[model samples]
Target: MPVLRQITTCTEPSTVVIERRVRTRDRSVDYRLEVCRRHRWLASNWTGRRSAEGSGGRCGTVMDYRPYAQIVQSHADLWLRPLAANGPEDHDGDLAAALRAGFEFLTAHREPTGVAIALEHAARITEAIAAGALPLVEGQAQVLAALSAAETLDAGARGA
Candidate 1:
């Protein structure tokens, strides 16, 4: 049997909950962390310090991008498949997880052109998901695919 643990922290503007299943015999840990940011104003205005032109304004540098690409690659299927099956409403939790992951990524990385549109998109998506009002758009999969592909490219460039 696996041991399950959960921790929830409520801050002023955000709350994070993490759940993990540990298999003691195998010494493996499987964890799912959910970050819920309630401060729309703050999240919307959050700016990434990195310039999209690469590391330190240098081109062709494989600067590290965080959770957005990683989240898209890992959890895109979770959001997309359910939309085709029973619809996202049936899997609200999974959908939220996917959206939150994407939001985390968008907030952490600046756009290639230094635009804040990505942050706006992230905020919109997060709100839609939170309200259970997200439309089942046809292009959703394509966007996720694009993000995932970027991660692949980044990995290749990094020689990983």
Candidate 2:
């Protein structure tokens, strides 16, 4: 097996790294997922290397590989839910804060060019929220749309 590429995305408490490898014989793609949460790690589709601890290796246990989109969607959902939830009177402020935090995190990990769409969407959402133009539900929809569009664009770039 030859290593291919790896991408990482992060939100507050978690960071997910997806490594894509291809088998030379059949040209099949294999996804290896690694997640870090508050300094703890969980990995899937591990390479079967044993650690000194020998408890299935560093990440604790191994799991089967999952589709790339599935992994991205799950992580996005987990991170985006709070932006959709009800909050105090300062809900819009909270939403803007959340968006800013997410944008910063994404910027730090991924290339600004790669995540330009997401950054644009986040700016729009926060601007609307600040200007009192977006209600909670509409804001959530826009966020979802933003993520969908970004994912679609990324997939297309990858020729997937």
Name the top TM-score candidate.
2
Over all chains combined, what TM-score does candidate 1 have? 0.24
Clashing pairs in 1: 68-105
Model 1 lDDT on a 0 to 1 scale:
0.34
Candidate 2: TM-score? Answer: 0.32
Residue-level error in angstroms, candidate 1, position 10? 42
As for candidate 2, its clashing pairs are: none
Candidate 2 C-alpha error for residue 148, in Å: 0.7
- The candidate maximizing lDDT is 2
Query: Model 1, 67-104: lDDT tens per residue?
Result: 33333433344332322232223445454444434444
TM-scores, all candidates, are 0.24, 0.32
Location of the lowest summed lDDT over 10 successive residues in candidate 1 = 1-10
Mind giving the per-residue lDDT tens digits that candidate 2 earns over 15-130? 44434555556545354444444323333333333222312222211122434334333434433343323221234435445544555555666665444456457557757856
- Candidate 1's displacement at residue 96, Å, is 4.9
Q: Provide the clash count, candidate 2.
A: 0
